[model samples]
Target: MHYIYLHGFASSPRSTKARDLSDRFAALDISLSIPDLNQNDFSHLTLSRQIQQVEALFPPAPAPVTLIGSSFGGLTAAWLGERHLQVDRLVLLAPAFGFLAHWLPRLGDQVEQWQTDGYLPVYHYSEAKELPLHYAFVADAAQYQEESIARSLPTLVLHGRHDDVIPLQASLDFARTRPWIKLVELDSDHALTDVSTEIWQAIQSFCAL
Candidate 1:
């Protein structure tokens, strides 16, 4: 199976988890591919566009792909696994379902301001700059009803109990209906840094070759 890891929004393949996974994969003599989702301008970033970017990485009729996606990327993987039959397994870290529900409340009146301005300036840690995300992002994301997407693949979801970005309840709600999904709660926050070793072990055991 081919392995690929999708990093969170405003993050890159250089993230701590990405680097750690790469090193672990090397030790296991495996190749783990990580693509840059935000290679284009943030103004052009949307769920549809990001999904298309991931689609472009496939080698024609190649080995089955096992996906590891974090945050927004985790949501991306969830969508892809539903649509693509070649996806064998999924490991999601703080997958962002019902994310706008959480974000909109935080943005509050800024939602109206962003729609009026056409874009919102969000700080991108990797770029060290505030990037412009078009209001189209919110609209595009709304197109995909999270619960409607199919998720029959072998899946594991790791969510931080203290995650301030996306709520732990989102995963709990889904896992309740879909008992096949293994949801592991971590003591860490959205970063999931505190339980890195445990998460790594789970990944290794889940996709053991």
Candidate 2:
């Protein structure tokens, strides 16, 4: 089985969660590919671009893949699973479901200003500074509707009950209709950083490691 780890938005392969999970997989004598979704150009990020980049990294055919993603990356993983039969399983950490709806409101007036300016300055967790991302990011993301992901597969979602970003209800709603998904609620927040071990344990059980 091939393993791939996709980090959250504004984050990188060096994120605490990514590195921790990578170490855990390595301890099991397995390699996890954590690609930089930014593609060295966060200024013009798009969901389609990310999907293309990660799909290219997938091992040729017959080799089944297991995708592990966090936040926006988790959302990306779900769509990939829907589009590709090679994806065998998914492990999502606080996925950003209805992300635009939940996030755009937080930006408030900046949303309109970003449209007018064609860019918005947001904090980059990995880069440790604010980065100007093009408004095209929002335009591209709006094209992907969460309700369209109907393909069924073995999936596990680890969401924080106290999550303020992508409310817990999002996962609950998602798992409600999809019997193949197992939703595990944790005590942490949106980051799920405090319960890394629990996440790893769940992955091991779900993946049968």
Candidate 3:
């Protein structure tokens, strides 16, 4: 069995959540693979490419793999679970569904400026730099706009009520639509701050699946 943790947008696998989870999973004798979704070019990141990269990481076998995705990575994991049959379970932390919609609005008038300028400056949490996101990123996400996870796998969603970025409602709507997906509301923000133990335990229990 493979244990993988997918990080969020602008965030890397070396994040506190990813490292702590990796350590906990290590103690359980489970190998966790947390790949950098940005790859080589943070300036031109796309979800589709990350999806393919993650798919390629797994060998051509029928081994069950559990996915632990955070924010943007959660969205990527959901896409993977929808396509691949080997994903046994999912543990999402504030997934960014309808991300384009949220992002465009957040940018407001800058959307036009970004489209005209061809790039938008955004902070990269992992790199600790204000990286420029190409306009192509938004266009790429549109390809999967109508796509959603219809699979009924054992899923656990941890969201924050104070999360203004992704909004807790998104997770609620997802869990509401799919009975198999369980949503947990935390008091923290979109970061799911100070909930490492809870997240680890949830992942471990879900790994038992």
lDDT of each: 0.88, 0.94, 0.85
Q: For residue 10, what is the lDDT in candidate 2?
A: 96
Tens-digit per-residue lDDT, 1-209, candidate 1: 88989999888888989999889899999999999888767666888988888887865675689899999999999998888888889999999988788888888899999999999998887888898889999999989998787667799999999999998999899778886699999898998877889899999888885
| Residue-pair clash count for candidate 1 | 0
Model 1 alpha-carbon miss at residue 184, Å: 1.0
Each model's TM-score, in the order given?
Answer: 0.96, 0.98, 0.95
Clashing pairs in 2: none
What ranges in model 2 sit over 4 Å off?
none
What count of clashes does model 3 give? 0
lDDT of 1 at 67: 90
- Which residue pairs in model 3 clash with each other? none
> Per-residue lDDT of 71-162 in model 2, one digit per residue for the tens?
99999999999999999999999998898999999999999999999999989989999999999999999999888899999999999999
Model 3 lDDT at residue 39: 92
lDDT of 3 by residue, 1-209 (tens): 78788999998878888888878878877788999888968889888888998999875679888888999999999988988999988888999988887778877899999989999999998888899989998888889953466888988899988998999988887778788988888878888858777776776676663
Error of 3 at 194 (Å): 0.6
Give the top-scoring candidate (TM-score).
2
Positional deviation of residue 209's Cα in model 2 after best superposition, in angstroms: 0.7
